[model samples]
Target chain A: MWETVLSALMDPVNALFLVGGVAGGIVVGALPGLTATMALALMLPFTFSMSPEPALIMLGGIYIGAIYGGSISAILINTPGTPSSIATTFDGYPMTRQGKPEQALVTAAFSSGIGGVLGGLTLLFLSPALADLALQFGPPEFFWVAIFGLTIIATLSAGSLLKGMIGGCLGLMLSTVGIAPIGGESRFTFGFSPLQGGLDLVVMLIGLFCIPEVLAMVDRKRVAKQGLALKREKGVAGGVIKKLVRQPLLLLRSSIVGIITGIIPGAGGNIASLLSYDLAVRFDKKHKDYGKGRMEGVVASEASNNAEVGGSLVPLLSLGIPGAAPAAVLMGALLIQGITPGPDLYTRYPDLVYTFIIAFIIANFVMFVMAFYGARYVARMIDLPADVLLPMIVMLTVIGSFAIRNSYLDVCMMLGFGIAGYFLKKVGFEPGPIVLGIILGPIAETGLAQSMLLGQAEGGVWQIFFTRPITLVLIVLSLISLLSAVYIQTSRAGWKAGRRDAETCDAD
Target chain B: MRRRLNREIGVSLFFLGIAVIAFIQVEGLNRMSAVFPRTLAVILLVLSGILLVQSLVRPPEKKKGETPLASSRILPFLLILVLYAVLIAGLGFLIATILFAGVGTWYLCDRNKIRAIIGSILLGILFYALFRFVFLVPFPGI
Candidate 1:
């Protein structure tokens, strides 16, 4: 572990990718419409052709960086670049109104850095134990785990639960397009020979996530927003840091809130930050003072969101279950690298796992450094014309899909999915549950099928599936997840800041 | 503005069709392969069925003004994407991208011939070089 950490730190290429991911993620996250998930999806092609360590390193950096970057727009422009920073606007924008934009930015940056590192530490320490526990998961347990993931994401990620489940079923059907996982027979090819391989996960990812956003941006291009001016002030960051250092518990509490929220599959950073901000208000000496230019508000919101990044990765690394959408994309990256994340990940590739975690913590520091110095310039990226950004991203999707197999067919399929995804989004089907379904489909199918074969000897199918202690626990959890999502939707009149929407799901 | 289909009713019917198609298709597969898909097909059918029934029972929620980023150009933009993909197979990656980017920028956003021409050329060249050189990604066409 020490050797891997040292090598990751000492390597120039690793440092470069980590820094670049951080800077790029911050810019994308601050762009309001662009999200960590889309950024990760766009960055997917870049990773497929590279080795595992650097890919994981860069993705970790981007995840942490983008979560913090949302706070920048929240502060200056009164818009969250990503949904995760919606809470930041409460006090962050007020701070901007008070001529303390730079101070607020620094406060956010500092708290995010501290929160992110703490959260990464939690992942570094906790994932091994989780992996050990997951090693106990058999075919039945794994099947239930997949079901749990699909249920949680579907209900939490979409506005309409029925529609979300339909989307999940759609994704499951898409996953079946090529060969049957267990039977090894071509199932849904519909006589298209090329589809015998099914859709490329990366291609679908680029299509489903990127293309919809590009078109959506085009639709909104007419509604223009102007940014507020940012002035550089000396010692602004220094003052914010010194003040934040005095309230260690506040930062720790917010980060804890973020970590716990992140561990619950569908509760994303937006939820984490809101819950943290609420807790801060309850404990704050002047209870009614939050959302009125309180630095603690910005700190709590930013810290929890960034920390959620680390907290979210724990499940992805240990159980192959992504806690959020960005983590889902990260799982795709892991798949691209020929690494299936699960219990064996710790045993088989200890070096890559350790390097990724340590590099993740290091990326937060890099993000802090870049955000402190380059926040103003990065804010200017939101100004780039949608026409340019859209076309460029379209080109990226073309090349990104093409590069994976050097196949124009994949590009066309990507475009097809993009078009379908656009129409799907128009009708309120989000990419979150679809992506989850696609990821979990193979796992669930193989788990159940294999369990069926095992049950031939172990008495009966019900005994195999329902009799296990672990499977029972997972079944109960899946029920709870589905019920809670239903209750939350029915109880609340409106969803705020899209707690599990595409962007906020990656707000992890 | 053109009259639009009732989204709730329309989406439910569309998904219902998909569910039927999926279930019918699963019948031709081996029993082993069909089991899982068959299960999903039923789920889709039931879910879409529930959605349709619910849509009929409840009044569709009235949409508020300023539906975030609503636009009429999506269908036209999708046509552009199809054209772009087709052009890639014939025109080759570079030339196709140049035409797509150039025309897309000019009509879609820039609306300035000079800037569109220059910007598209620059973008086309930059991406061509990156894919051609930095990544060494092979383009299938000329």
Candidate 2:
């Protein structure tokens, strides 16, 4: 293992890919409206030719870099480069306003690197044990896990529970448009040959995530004319390191929060960082200074979000289930390479797993170095005009969709989904749950069919669900996730209503 | 609020329609193949019904007067995307991309005809180089 790691590090080609992936990732991450998942989706077709190890290494680099890179724009323009960095904008932008942008940038970089490394270490050590646990999962348990993932994600993503579930159902329906998983029958092709193949997950992902973003760019073109450029003090980040040293526990706790959140199938970086920020504020003695340019807020948000990169990969590496959306895309990329991720991944290919882990750790260091030196140049990606940027993104998405199977049918599918996604997004339905549905639909179907067959052989169909301890645990977790999502969403809505009432009373 | 409720109700109806269609499709399939999708369709139908009822009970507050796709400018942009997709395979990727980017930039970004044309061509070449040359994607035309 050490020899392979050494060879990977020594291999000039591997080094180039690592650096190139991080650089590309940072550019994508620093650009507003571009996400880590979209970056991976765009890059997936290209990775098709490469071997699995280098392919994963490059993807891993992008994942880590993109997550950390989001902080750059969050600190500079108050707009998070990615959704995960949304919390960073709270304190980061304020620091920039105070002419302490360097401080915020440094803290974010340091924390992201630290958090990412810690998370990567967690993946390295913990994935094997998790894979061992996953081996106990039978077909019924697998079905339950998929259901738990789909329901929780769908229920949690949208502002309204109904809309989220609708999105999930819509995705499941889309996945069912091709052939039946169990029985050899065409389902919903409507007499089109392309429909027989079904909607490609990559095509759907690009269309759902990238196309609407392009349309949004056009829609907001007039409003998005403003450019953000900030001045930086090069050596100022040194002081942030000293300050961060004093609060080791906060960083550790935030990374742990990120890791745990990442392990949960649907919980992602945005949730991880926000939860970490809330914990930081709740536990801090200087809570009042939290939203007001405090360094701790920057640290907690950046650390947790960066850490989420590693955390999210844990499930993808162990079980076939993706821990987050980006990881889902990564899983798709793996599947494209004919590398199905499951418990067998760790056992069947320990070298690939170990090498990828090492590459992930190395990518963090590369991101740290690049972010430290290249912040000024990479941050300029914000100034690229929407007209140019949007069209360029459109070009890539169109071509990328076609490249999936060299099929124009996929391109049309992408455009159709993109338009639908744009409208769906406006109506309060999130695309996240929909993506989850598409990814998990086949898994659930196969498991359900196989479990039913097993059940018939044993006793009864209904007994399979209740007899398994794992299934029961999954059901309980699903219930908790659904209930908590409801509680949080309703409370937020109520609070908004209360504020509106207060304002109305004051006006009266 | 009424507008939002209308949208939600419409969306719910759409889902319900899809559920009905899916249920019908599942009817002819074997039990192994039919069970999962049928179950999903029923779940979707129930969920859609719940959504419709909720929207009727409590409509959300509206902040904007217009819907997202209501802008007069949006239809042309969308039409251009569809036209581009329809034309790309016949026109070749490079030509299609250049045309799409050029026209899209002219309409969506800058009206300067020369700048839009030149900039679009440059972007087209750049993308071609990256995907075709660097990434080796063989995007149907160099």
- Give lDDT tens digits, candidate 2, residues A1-508: 6787678777888888889999999888888777888788778777866788778888899988888888888888888888899779878988988988878888998999899999999999999898998899999888988887876775337477777877887787778877887886888887777788778988898888777777766776642224555566765777779889898999999999999888877778887888798789889999878667899999999999989889888888888888888998888778778888988898888878888898899899999989887887777666777777778778878777777688777888889999989878877777888998888888888889999889999989879988888899989988887776676567546645754674576579
For candidate 2, the C-alpha RMSD (Å) to the true structure equals 2.8
lDDT of 2 by residue, B29-99 (tens): 88887888899899999999988787788776776445554467677888889888877878888898899
User: Model 2 chain A: which ten-residue window has the lowest total lDDT?
Assistant: A221-230
List-wise, what DockQ does each model earn? 0.61, 0.64
- Candidate 1 lDDT tens digits, A376-464: 88766667677777788899888888877889899988888887887788777888778778888888898888888788777786679
Q: Could you tell me the TM-score of chain B in model 1? A: 0.87
Predicted structure 1, TM vs. truth: 0.94
Tell me the spans in candidate 2 whose CA falls farther than 4 Å from its real position: A222-235, A487-508, B64-67, B140-142
Candidate 1, residue A273: Cα displacement in angstroms equals 2.4
- Provide C-alpha RMSD values for all models, in order: 4.0, 2.8
Q: Report the CAPRI category for model 2.
A: medium
Q: What is the lDDT of residue A59 in candidate 1?
A: 88
Best by TM-score: 2
